[model samples]
Target: MNEDKNRIVSHGAFVVRYRAAGAYRFEAHSHPYLTVTSVMSGMLEAEIGSSHLVAAPEESLFTNSFQSHSGNGSDLEFVSVGITAEAVAEAAINAGFTKAGADIAFNNSYSSDRSVAEIARAIAAEVLSEEPGRNAMLDALISQLVIVLLRSHLRVKRSPLIELSRAGPVDRRLRRAMEFMHDNYSRDLGIEEIAQAAYLSEYHFARLFRRVTGVTPHAYLANLRLEQARELLINTGESISDIAGAVGYQSQSHFTKAFKAVTGLTPKSYREGTTRAVEPAEAGKAGLESSNKVSSGE
Candidate 1:
């Protein structure tokens, strides 16, 4: 089995990423957001907490905040939509869910909702295209998915007030570290430096940081740089090498490899909005397949 090649497209309220067809397995981990993965092809076998589930083409799988999930997929290609808990809460309120302040969770780990499948495919299309109004279109599509889940798939867990009030000194220090990273992401930084910003020893900072954010400091910083690089790719006409330097990558080759590894497209290709991995025609066929499955009661 090989590692999956991932392509990410970040939006305001949600992030959509595509995992290329391959055999891959991931260790048990958790996220602070709601993830809805729509299988475009092949099958996904996953374990979310205590439940074991399989999602097939035109079906979707859900993982709510901090719910431990691990999975393996064989020849699997999918688009995963990650919506923050905050976004879900907002949608829940809009959908008339009374317990919006409580923790939001999914009632089912797997979904065969036709509407969700449709919207997921639409989002994939938008991601693969450079169509005008792409941002607006994605916002609308993601909103529909959230609304559908709120109406049919959500459950609320009443949480203790104390849990919400855990923003103690240590948490404040973590926030400081995060702010430091954000402010200095364009420069080469080190773990010791970041740890110093949090006013903790490197060992302590690393441990608490992962415990809080679910990723190592280095991984977080890499993601931060890539995010900034992505914005530069989309919004500006900066040359690739200059953007690479601005994002703290010392060399163009290193920056290109990192960008392509995460995005499945070279920086040049992404900036051009011409992804050769999934063509427009192929994406359209996927949309049709999802629609046909709905009509045939699959």
Candidate 2:
């Protein structure tokens, strides 16, 4: 959305996202790249396949490429590094798993390695500063994360012997309802309309949806909207008022209140914290200035 090239830092083979604080949920989804999320504070509740995981501070979670996983955070600060599959393969080869590159995966979703946690924080620091060599620092950090995973946690990819199922008409209805919520989260959505999408009455829909998701439809939609707003704040130069409207909130004040309640930071503060970066020429100039100071022995 934000066409400003400065807002985005290009890491050649990885994508990095950071959240300073928030309650957020990602509905069931899969990606072609592997993801490692390190939680620096609070907790992350997630579901990977049939496994439910809770990662607290100093813990990291791994999701292999194409693994269907979903997670929600509770007042957390985290950095998630998304590594391209090709990068993983190359890393695996360099780790002496040359024949196993195609088979590399994580059998488990949870890790408590301190190196992973520290590297995650380093990546976050690099993201927030305009320090010289920021891009190079990020690339090296990403490579460190990958190396840690390959050395300490790599597993062979394999097919499950049996499939787990939640199959039934009710499950189908609930999924349809979730799909509707996801598709139209940018607009004001109501219970009645959402119920119709699931082919259920409003009363039953409210009850069943909560039972299935452990959260009400309204809560789910709000989380989805706030997550979108968070991304806009981090990656775009849009005003807070504009972001509120884009995420379906009619009032800027209301959006600010809700955002602070969940994230522990105002929208403006969050944006300011996440978008700091130095242009190459400016960084070079700053380095030169520092060198001049050192030469003068001041």
Candidate 3:
């Protein structure tokens, strides 16, 4: 099946596009750049190697350069964005990494990632809607998708943090609240208080906060709290419960869960001078390199 020509939107750095609905299958083809794809509906069967990875609704896939992959599904509605090899290499340089980092691969073919899938949906929606600012919207969403892909799927260094202009009028409103969050994360703070800090209503504050920071206020606050808690853990001799309370968590268990989510260690493990546990580099361990047989799939 051919893709909808109207669905393709390209900026020099990236491309946001989607396939038209019909019987869909690929008899093993490969591209020269990175292709990140998402299946909005229908099941996609991907043969990565000896295993067949299935991508269902809201699941995305990553294919590395020159990796042969094929898919089979009926009436599959999906969106994909490709980062050109030159663009990927340039992003690596911008992030202070070697050019080779841009050619990274995914350990798993299908990812049930909310952020990646949502970006794809948003790009597709903007494409189909013929929105007034379609190019800008698509560029923003596609850029975010690239960041998520590099961090989560490729496990590269997260060097290029958000760097939008705080001088913008809308962004100026959030600067004070951002500072407030940084200073007061260890208090019993909520969105209402943060919005009050910015003199914005909660809904408006939430929308603008995410628009500026690429995360919700609550998430940003939680990250700040966790970072502070880690500093205290490493530098001080405070008890776990004291640290939890100081970090604004009402209960130690909740704080522990949040800490582990970010650091991969419980408070006790962290404070006792234990190194963070490493996720088994299963794919790398298995010598899952690009080859004639092992193909990274999308």
Candidate 4:
């Protein structure tokens, strides 16, 4: 895939474009760019790692950097606009979302005929016009697209079935224990160490931890390690033994057992299950090297 060809138009910081033709099949790939696709006149299906969704005319989708997926249009007219990943991250931070997890992957299919057709017409008008402030015009249109999709996305409300009005003594202790566990999951951890981290006796900490998170501290640690291991397995070429050690498992077998227990697949199997190659333009720009530095507090 040609990164330059993928980039349609760059307005200040955001790049925008549309897709209409081409076969509906692409290998799994990732980029350091942000992507927002507005289905103009046909249906498109996308696979993000293990997740899948479909978008119809006037519907939209958003993806963040290094997201692995493949897509194709069902009919002829399918197009999408993309922005750089850095811009989206900056927007997320501005929106007060700190731990901006993975890319925001979602899709919306139009249920009402009139609405879908109207949005498609609107998109076509915008794409064809060479009016002044066209870039800004596209930005506004994309923003509206995001709003429409988000309004359709389902968000489950926290259960009112159980409520905690105030932090009880047990709750306070458990909260502390959870914080310690999150901060120390990469290290060689123990129940005793975690209890001490929370200033609680071992027995009390173990019981309370289970009550809050629905899992024992040790079990929770194992889950965290597995998640970290999976991330490394998919994103990096680190050896299995090294990844196991880095995430706190002393033995490769132990890590493999726990990983399979949680994810239902061995580490190697999970990695190979979705072997997405990066596009050359994206790969060339990859890495974490910083060109400039500034001094911190004295």
**Candidate number achieving the greatest TM-score relative to the actual structure:** 1
Tens digit of lDDT per residue, candidate 4, span 1-298? 1111111332323434444444345444443344555565667777765568787765655554345556655443533444443444344445443333323333422233344345544654655454654444555665554344334431212222222212211244455665676677778887998899788899988887665544567656665566457557755789999999989888999988767644334677656533332223333332221111111100
lDDT of 3 by residue, 211-237 (tens): 655457776676667756765665567
What lDDT score goes with residue 84 in model 1? 69
Model 4 segments more than 4 A misplaced: 1-175, 273-298
All candidates' TM-scores?
Answer: 0.63, 0.53, 0.47, 0.39
Top candidate on lDDT is 1
Q: Would you list the clashing residue pairs of candidate 1?
A: none
Among all windows of 10 consecutive residues in model 3, the one with the lowest summed lDDT is: 287-296
Better of 1 and 4 by TM-score: 1
Please give the range of 10 consecutive residues that has the lowest summed lDDT in model 4.
289-298
Screening candidate 3 with a backbone cut-off below 3 angstroms (N, C-alpha, C), the clashing residue pairs are none
Q: Against the unseen true structure, what C-alpha lDDT does each candidate score?
A: 0.70, 0.67, 0.61, 0.50
Kindly list the per-residue Cα lDDT of model 1 for residues 42-74, writing each as its tens digit: 888988877899999899999865456778778
Model 4 lDDT on a 0 to 1 scale: 0.50
